[model samples]
Target: MITLTLVGIGSGNPEHLTLQAVRALNDADLILIPEKGKAKDELAQVRREICANVLTSDVHIQGFDLPIRNEAITDYDARVNDWHDRIAVIWKQQIDAHLPDGGKVAFLVWGDPSLYDSTLRIADRIQANMPLDVKVIPGITSIQTLTAAHAIPVNTINGPFVVTTGRRLRDEGLPAGIENVIVMLDGECSFTGLNPDGLHIYWTAYAGMEGEINLSGPLSEITDEIIATRKAAREDRGWVMDIYMLVRSTP
Candidate 1:
């Protein structure tokens, strides 16, 4: 049986590894790392760093090129489904080449797998063809890291909150009947499209890493500053991973 472990490594920080994640790392027969081209080499580097720091026992580290999704396809769900199929093929090919006998293979997922991550979906695709046993190791999420960086609670006392993707927030606007929203998977700063009136925004890029950037306050007041800083950081590093929380300021 193929033992597939989807381990959450947290927000690209070596220190974010929990004791359980460390143990999972040590027990893996092979670890898969995705290389996102030259533009996002840091992602693969971070995965390697996590293995270097956490794995004392010798474990096979396998790096594979990540399949880039075609955003040109207008149908969002269709595009994602096609992408997942491609990724699963790559996963199976890598595992088969490295572990022809189907031993334990692990993937380091950013944040928790239960969140807005496609790793689980991709794994499921592979399992349809191969006999597989899957396990998820939870880790601190980007939402938690963003809130902690701002030193603010994710929601008001007894207030409702929602977690969503950047595309939804931009397309749907602030969701109905929710005071707090945590936005992720946003390549562009979608907040620029919203009406900033009475809105409080807390933004963090590289949420839990050494070079984290944070900006908060009335959206109108700090929007420009956050955008400028985010641009600079992304240019400096060749890529950036960011998340933000917004709340309609209340009396």
Candidate 2:
């Protein structure tokens, strides 16, 4: 049986590793790291650094090229499904090659797997083809890190909140009967399309990591500032991981 462990490493900081995650890293037979590209080399490096910083036992660590999603696929779900299939195949290939006898392999996931991450879903594809035992070690999510960085409670007392993606935020305005909403995967800064009145936004780039940027205030007052800051950071680093929380300022 192949033991697959998905360990959440938290936002880009090496210090984000929990004791459980450290133990899982040191216990793995093989650790797979995704090599996105030259532009996101640091993401892979951060994974390596986590191992370097916390791993005590010698573990086989390998870097694999991540399959880039085909934008030409047109259908969003289809494109994502195809991309995941490719990744699962790559993972299976790596496991077969390295662990002919069936041993434990681990992946370092950013934030908790239960959140917007697709790691768990991709792992299901591998399970379809093999006898697999999966274990998930939860770590701090970007949402938690974002709120912690801002030193604000995630929701008002006795109130409910919703978490969504930028696409939904743009397509469907804010959810009804909710005062707080979180957009986790927003490359487009969907808030720009919304009416800023009575909306307060707390946005941060690279939360819990170096070069962190925080911008918060009346959405109307700092919408342009957040956009410019996001653009500048992306240009400087070739990539940016960000999240923002929008609260209805009035009622």
Candidate 3:
């Protein structure tokens, strides 16, 4: 049986890597890094830097091109499922070619795999084709980094918060009774559509990295600033990952 370990490398900072993540890196027989092309090459580069810093054992490292999801398909679920299927095939081919007899293989995942990441789903697809044992190592999430960078609590005292994606936030708007909403995977600034009177936003892009940017204020006052800053950051870096928390005051 092949031991498939998914190690969460945390956000962009190498210091964000936990002791367990470092140990996992040293123990892997082979580590697979996904290349997301030139546009996002820094992401893959960060993983390499982490390995270089922590890896003492001589382990084989391989880089594979991450398959791009088809945007032509109108059905979101169908598009994602098809993309995951293709990724699984590529993963299997790499494993077979490198370790024909089966051994411990690991993949470095950004943030925790359980949160908004499809690595677990894609791994399930791989299990259907081969004997596999999956293990997950959790790391600091973007929400954690965002909150820490902004020096604010995620939820108010004796209150709750909802974590959701950009698409859901846009389609559903802010949930009716919830005071705190953490939005991720939001390429579009969905907060602009909400009634910004009583809402405060804490936004961060590239949290924990050297070039991290943060902005927080009443949503009404900074919505345009956030949009312009986000656009400029994306243009300068070739890609951008951001998360924001919205807190609406209780009447």
Candidate 4:
């Protein structure tokens, strides 16, 4: 039986790694790190650095080139589903090649697996071909870092918050009566599409990393600033991972 442990390493901060995550890293027979090409090679490097820092045992570490999503497909769902399928095939090949006998293998995930990440779904696809036992070790999310960096509560005393993607926010405006909205996986500045009046935005890029940048203020006042800052940061770094929270000014 293959024991697949998905360990969340949290944001870019090594200190964000939990005790359980550290233990899981040392306990794994093999760890798979995905290479996201030259543009995002630093991402794979972070995982390698994490492993080097905490791993006390002789755990085998392998880096596999990740499959790029075919942006040519106009259908969003079809494009993403096809991408996940291809990733699963690549995962299976790596696992089979490394662990022919089926031992414990771990994949270091960014943030909690239960969040927007699709590692769990890709693992599910791998299950169709092998006997696998999956485990998740939750770690800090970018949302947590974003909030903590801005020193704000995610929600009001008795209010609820909706966590969603950029595309969804752009397609459908903020949910009615939901004052708190957390946006992720947004490459575009979708918040600019919303009614800036009576809204506040706390935005952060590379939330917990060394080059972290933060902007927070009335949406109307800082929309352009955030967009320009975000653009320049991405251009300088070659890649950027960001998240933001939008809070209605009134109760």
Instruction: Please state the error at residue 232 of candidate 3 in Å.
Output: 0.9
lDDT of each: 0.90, 0.92, 0.91, 0.92
TM-score of each: 0.96, 0.97, 0.97, 0.97
Q: Would you give me the overall lDDT of model 3?
A: 0.91
Model 3: per-residue Cα lDDT over 1-251, one tens digit each: 78999998888899999999899888989999998766458888988988999999999999999889899988999999999999999999999999899899999988899999989999999999899999999999999999999888888889989999899988999988999999999998988778899998999999877699999998988999999999999999888899999999722
Pairs clashing within candidate 2: none
Q: Worst 10-residue stretch by lDDT in candidate 4? A: 35-44
lDDT of 2 by residue, 4-66 (tens): 999999998888889999999899999999997754588899888889988889899999998
Instruction: State residue 56's C-alpha deviation in candidate 4, in Å.
Output: 0.4
For TM-score, candidate 1 versus 4, the one ahead is 4
Q: Could you give candidate 1's per-residue lDDT for residues 1-251 as a string of tens digits?
A: 88999999888778988999999989999999998676457878888988998899989998889889989988989998989999999999998899898789999998889999989999999989999899999999999899999899998899989999889988999998889999998988999999999899989999888798888899988989988998899889888889999999832
Please report, as a residue range, the 10-residue window in candidate 1 with the lowest summed lDDT: 35-44
Best-to-worst order by lDDT is 2, 4, 3, 1
Clashing pairs in 4: none
Minimum summed lDDT over a 10-residue window in model 3 is located at 35-44
